[model samples]
Target: MESPASNSPRMRLDHLRKEGSGETHSRVFELEPCDHDNWSNPRFGSMNALEILRETVRILRYNSSGFMAIAALLICPVSAVLLSNVLVDLSLVKRLTIRLLLVSKSSGLPLRPFIKQSCQKFAEMAISSATCFPLFITLSLLSKAAIVYTVDCSYSRKKFDTSKFYGIICKIWWRLVSTYLWVCMVIVGCITFFFLVLAAVCNSFAIIGFSPNLVVYAAMTVGLVFSVVFANAIIICNIAIVISVLEDVSGPEALLRSGALIKGQTHVGLLMYLGSTIGMAFVEGLFEHRVTTLSYGDGSSRVWEGPLLVIMYSFIVLIDSMMSAVFYYSCRYSTMESSDGEECQSILESVVVSPQAMDVQ
Candidate 1:
């Protein structure tokens, strides 16, 4: 009983629906290429540890000039001071060592040779760190910020804009500083916890009349556990620094976000940390032997060897920072993929519901 004019409108609606269905299928086909491209892109796709390292190297190569400048200006100074121990006060180290020994003796703990050695090393490290704390907050942190920003620009297919980077750093400097302070506190807390636990274990063994050898073995086991925990903590803090610079979060929130981001990627982080630690240690050993302890040709070898080792040490540090930045992206990309799957499903459901609603209308 409908008029022919009304029938025409219905026919037109049916034709449009048919066209819409075809277009939807074509859109889906188009998305396949996009998905493939995204999956192939290193920045968009999830990467393994080795892949991340490769990408970091690529980024470094791409922005070598910028990174080198940052390393020379900031990182090299820190490395030189640390390697030469120029800023460390030997008197302060001795006093601190004595204080630590006295405290341990007063606490009724046995002052074994191992304990004395540990105290001496700890005191020296503490003094050096205190002396270099200023450099750490200023130049070292600035270098990290610069490296992170440069890596981000490289990933985005842009050049490093110094003026823009400076502006960005100025705004985020406080945040970076706050995050670093928190990181230091966390590290100190971990060391304190390690010592307390070690002390307790030793005390328990003493009470049980355990052999000294057994106590030493137990201490070694504890040291192994502490090493793993400490490595994990360092990885988390490094990622937190990246997060603080690249995102809006800082301090504890950045740390929490980093922990969440790295949940399934701890092994990768551990491997990266291991590689960097080894590289730095090797450089330090070379510096200690060639420049500080051993003398060759009236110590002229140190003239070149010391600077060469410092450069190597700085380069290692640069790579480590870059790796941390790349790791952040790798973790972030993986996280996005999981979230994107859920989003795509919801979108598909909505698309399906839309046609049904149109039919009802």
Candidate 2:
């Protein structure tokens, strides 16, 4: 007998059984190396161009990803600015409405436009935010327990445990809501104070055009600087919140950890964030512009468009999360490692210690 030595990709149980012996036997099958090994080069200690693209595609497909990331890459800043403007307008209108009632003027203030605008703005935000959820879920909804569950069933340890993937995302969600509330409180307090000071300055100017008081100009300068600082700090805090959640640390700890991670990498992170913002904005602009046209009692053409845009926007959000996850993991990889199987790279740098390794026992 020739003895079916590696006859095919897989061997039959009958052949293996027949070939079995005390001294020698043919194994049922030979295993191939995991995909990761093929994508990574040991000599280079980094993925090459092809591998990078492949991994990117893998991530997008793996999560059954959405488009928010692509849109986030596009429209983040523009949408943020627009949202801010809408909020300012709505606030102004509300103030006017209350002031009118107090003065007992004809309660016939034009309600249609304001109501329409408010609804439009709210719809935009809610829809955009909701679409962004799935993108976030790509990385947002999985867990370590899920990862362990996946690992338990996986034939190789080299693959990412896709199951618990959302642990980081869940943390981000909780942290963002928490951070948003905190930031809103701070922003509200500061904005209230800012407007008061501005009102005083404006009232002073009301008595005189472009009041020559150096104090007025100085106050103007102060306001500009304050706005810039406030905006930048909040954005940084948002990123820090996400970092914190992924890293599994206290709020303050997360802030410091994010600061460290972002210290040398601010420019890269900025560009990527900007990309997400730009992509989202272009799509948002088109939709909003169309909505503006539709508000003229011509909602006919756009009746079906809103949901379609939302779904497409959600896809972008999905892509946005994937992009963030990719960039994060890429930067997080380290060439150096501790003896106990830990790496020093800073994307959270979480190292889980097993019971056997811990000194607690």
Candidate 3:
């Protein structure tokens, strides 16, 4: 049997195509690999999650610069969020929303004041939303650049694919913001639906003068919403990131592509995301549960949760970085794409091996 020059030669194949050409007709004899040389198979069809995870770590560890750059990017998000809270108070954006909602409801408020408040808050949320993706992308890219482009890194000699990074940013920038908007909308909608349900139940019982249900209803509603949002946040955050690692599409396109591919198989990928997030969140929760209750400052109520949360969030960021690598793997199994080419992408395909025949030259 003639062997195909390019493709899953591991499946056992015969091929006929012009030399130096990519197109060819090849056949496979068995379901299993006839040639086992290809580990980084684009199909990624065989490896389990554990094997993928092992390969992922191996790939990252290949270059020390890659590792360090991702590390810095990991820290950037936590630092930005904490600093933004302390120095800028992003809730001010939501505060504007609150003031507007109030003005709208107030009959005594003048028309001019109502419009002013509404417009101001609307403006704030918009600015906050817009600022978000860029900040995240900048911090991430800056860290990647810092590590990948370092002049003295051992692997610096490996010509960096500069287009790959920009492609990632393009694929994630708008995606993170828009999907996040949609996710928040979904969560708010869910909570609102449940709130109304519980509210009705509460009002019925309260009217009989049995008991006020506001606290219980509110607590239940809040808990359900929090749980859903927290879990979704981890996955969506992964989506934002998985979208980034894609090289074949822009931000919006990657979202569409990934969404379509992730439909039935999001469990492992989502776990790959939320698992890390939950682990970090558990650490943060431990701090809140045991540490905060134990460590109160002299004049400040600060339990140092801020810094610890920041650190844990950074660890999430690292896991996020690592997960993106797997996302690239999982993607190939299902044919998702980005605007970037494989040459420019981070995914590495294994060199498929095949049976050989000694040739007379």
Clashes per model (N, Cα, C within 3 A) = 0, 37, 12
- Which ranges of candidate 1 are over 4 A from the true structure? 1-44, 101-116, 341-361
Report lDDT (Cα) of residue 116, candidate 3: 65
Please, what are the lDDT tens digits per residue for candidate 1 over residues 156-175? 44566765565576567889
Q: Note each model's CA RMSD in angstroms.
A: 14.4, 15.2, 13.6
Give per-model TM-scores: 0.80, 0.46, 0.49
- Model 2 residue 59 lDDT score: 43
Off by over 4 Å in 3: 1-43, 46-52, 80-85, 88-134, 140-237, 244-253, 285-312, 335-361
lDDT at position 165, candidate 2: 34
Q: Rate the local accuracy (lDDT) of all candidates.
A: 0.75, 0.40, 0.44
